[model samples]
Target: MQVDADSFLSGSSRRWVAHYRKNLDRDWQIPWSSGTALTSGEKQRIAASIAEFQRGEASEAQDYLGKSSAFSTVARDPDFHAASILFVAEENAHAALLLRFMQETAIATRQHSFSDVVFRWLRSIGDLGWSSRVLLIAELIAQDYYPCLRAATNHAALHRICDKIEYDEKAHVRFQTERIARLEAGRSDPAVGLRRGLQSVLLCGAIVVVYLEHRPVLRARLSFGKFATTVLRRNRRAQRAINANRRCM
Candidate 1:
């Protein structure tokens, strides 16, 4: 089933019941398993922050769709198209899950205004055939970011949700990494090398912008400087891996 933000918030219970029947009642192990642990004010603020983050992610996903259409000239390449579609689907799922969680808890939030611009830029970058690479970077970022945020969140319910999301996100990164490797291996043209280099640069730029957009959330929940340093270090590692693999090919 194609899950998006609207459907996720509106139909989460049914979806979970249908797909994860046994796991439904299991005690959520992440930080926010118990809703009662947080004051009403804390719940409201956390919900607002999550809602804003979802808005940004969803905006970027929409932009990716538009950008994919333009990149369809190269869509004859099955790996490229598949990676693009998968990345969008995963992001959509992330947004939907967050929305559903917020609605279930009755958390109030004011939508942020910057979401549109960020997504537009994301969509423009999507056409560069870098979706897989970007997904890899995003996954790496999430590995650190989610854990840090989870530690900072006092609400048990929120922490549990983040834990579940983090688990799914890790799986996503593994899938995308393999896909990227496959795509890179199948390429033969010297021009493809140059394109890959350019795409890496673009992906780095996109990551920076995403980090900047979420700076407030990071700053409030954890040390923004630490988060930024961690993200950059991971990104550099990924770049090195990509370069090394290309050379081996």
Candidate 2:
């Protein structure tokens, strides 16, 4: 289920709205009763990683609401504003799901992480376009990160939760990538190229930071090179999607 802009962002957001609405009714039936028995090393590694990710998820979309009106106006998609609201709700849902897992597993959540702080700062300083690029970068990282997290722990509940999060994240990246393409469509080639270049640099730095930060869980399934390659590949696909949309326009 590769999510490109055309299939996702056709004039009306009815499909997008319906998609999120459908997900809201989903029942994951995570086995909360199944206790998570982790090795000391696993616990030590995953606790901070989950906490940081949970915090990051919770903090996202706060500013997105404020900027979405401008997005609707610029993109000329009336439903985009409504769709953006649903997007924010879905993000908050992911945060809640992670928090539930953390609570059941006795993993304490964190207040702040260095990566989260920096990412937040980047989001804060930018307009919707820049902020969305940052958000998409995080989603690309999560595309890999969640799979490693599912494999790192033996907990069925965590696996289920990760599956749900991963599922939603794929759609999120697609939605965001399309939205970004529309936003960048009217910009000069050099401007879009420069932003893409900046995204590449940010993506590289983010990969290194996240890999080190969650090395234990990530190492369970991927080496640094493999992880970096996977995320970079996803980023490239998104870049291609944006470019393709621009060409069509």
Candidate 2 lDDT for residue 216: 87
Per-residue C-alpha lDDT of model 2 across residues 65-178, encoded as one tens digit per residue: 788877777656668788888988888888998998788668998986877888888987878888889989999999999999999878888899899999999999988887
lDDT of 1 at 128: 41
Off by more than 4 A, model 1: 1-37, 59-86, 109-112, 126-128, 132-138, 174-221, 247-249
lDDT of 1: 0.55
Query: Please, what's the RMSD in Å of model 1?
Result: 9.6
Query: lDDT per residue, candidate 1, 178-248, as tens digits?
Result: 44443465566575567556655754564566567555446555565566576667666665565554454
TM-score of each: 0.60, 0.91
Global lDDT for candidate 2?
A: 0.85
Best by TM-score: 2
TM-score attained by model 2? 0.91
lDDT of model 2, residue 16: 79
Which stretches in model 2 have alpha-carbon errors above 4 Å? Answer: 1-12, 74-76
